[model samples]
Target: MKKIILTIIYILTLSGCGLEQGSYLVGWWNGDIPTKLSDKEEKIWDICREKTKYLPKNTEEEKEKADMELNNCLHEKGFWD
Candidate 1:
């Protein structure tokens, strides 16, 4: 199961699908096929999607904080085990 998931990730990553988007989708799959995002997950996805827009304007410390917050958000939402 892990291998299959990893393979899919690898393929998606290499297919120019955007690693962040691919990883988010794969993690949210929760071992089943992913067909849609829940409301909460969609909110997180929106944040991630807009990150690049604001991240570059942030200072190093701000960026670090934002990254940590995002990581925590993902973990709290079960983006990964």
Candidate 2:
């Protein structure tokens, strides 16, 4: 009985059966983060590197929004002709 219960618990934990969508586990599993920069991306990265160092003190949500805006700007100007 103990082995059976432990096995069931282990499977449930591994499956993330009851986890919320916004949990950190979900974010990590989604892998939306960029890990490397292409040449073009590097150019945009250089252009934005200074801005990244100077982000203003703000709430977490506001900072995330600012980062998203910066990423959108980089995408628009870097890849779009």
Candidate 3:
């Protein structure tokens, strides 16, 4: 009975840890192309989206610039900020 209780506790702890890790990467869309983004900006958007976890969730938006200008024009004006 003691061993069963320990096993359950361990499973619960691991499940909680998994949930925390999953939550850290929320709001990241998994797609080859964001339909709202332009064709020329799709590549940069994908890169930025994958790296979203490393960026601020609010206030300070992560902007990806290409060719001396912001390439993600569509995404810049949307929910990112």
TM-score per prediction, in order, is: 0.35, 0.45, 0.26
What local lDDT score does residue 57 receive in model 3, on the 0 to 100 scale? 38
Clashing pairs in 1: none
C-alpha lDDT values of all predictions = 0.68, 0.74, 0.50
lDDT-best of 1 and 2: 2
lDDT of 3 at 24: 31
The TM-score obtained by model 1 is 0.35
Per-residue lDDT over 1-81 for candidate 3, one digit per residue giving the tens place of the 0 to 100 score? 999999999997886664532353332432333247565556655665565535443443333333213335436634243
For candidate 1, write residues 4-58 as lDDT tens digits.
Answer: 9999999977876554645756666557455677777787767665654455535
How much lDDT does candidate 2 score?
0.74
10 residues in a row with least lDDT, candidate 3: 60-69
Ranking by lDDT: 2, 1, 3
Q: Measured by TM-score, how close is model 2 to the native structure?
A: 0.45
Pairs in steric clash, model 2: none
- Order of the predicted models by TM-score, top scorer first: 2, 1, 3
